[model samples]
Target: RSDRNNAIRSPTSIDMDHNDQDEVPTASLGTWIFLVVVAAVSFWSQATVTEERFVPALNVIANIFNIPDDIAGATLMAAGASSPELFSSFVALFITHSSLGLGT
Candidate 1:
């Protein structure tokens, strides 16, 4: 058991041991700044697109289907929130034959 523990604590194994606090690694300040800037830009772009295009498209869809605005919005929101998980589950069950995505 001690030999196993020593092997795990060896230099090469240090990289694989996530629980070791003494050798914690982190991204550089520049990398963190770049990530923050990229995230902000992405969020801004998504918000702009949703405001300029998605809302108008949703309105048009509701009008075409004669769906109440609230109902259409609720349905769209629910579908948007669930579709990724549903697709992942299908892929996990059928293509990958794994339960990982279902658990997620």
Candidate 2:
């Protein structure tokens, strides 16, 4: 059986809702805005927080780096999320510094 996805022509996605009956452009515009905002936030999280769980973080950062002047103003959003992880990793690293802690 052929894959359903194979039928589609365009490989990349750009959200464009087309229905001929109603030509209200507002909804489509709103969709674009939402996508853009999400991409921006994705960019910031990935870019700034150089922590280990940096997959999503990197994606968000890439959006910012690759895109135009388009990062959402809240740059610290990802850093805020990363604080707990960062703290824990720091503590782990500290503990690992001493072999004394390794033995019960």
The best candidate by TM-score is 1
Which stretches of model 1 miss by more than 4 angstroms?
A: 1-19, 87-104
Encode model 2's per-residue lDDT on 4-89: one tens digit a residue: 65567354432344455686556688899999999999998866664555446555765767733234224445666667877666
Task: Summarize candidate 1's per-residue lDDT along 7-83 as a digit string, tens digits.
Answer: 76868677676567776888999999999999999999999987898788888988999999999899975776688
Q: Which sections of candidate 2 miss by over 4 Å?
A: 1-27, 51-104
TM-score of 1: 0.56
lDDT by candidate, in order shown = 0.85, 0.60
TM-score of each model, paired residue for residue: 0.56, 0.24
Model 1 RMSD, rounded to 1 decimal: 7.3
- CA shift of 6, model 1, Å: 11
- What lDDT does model 2 reach? 0.60
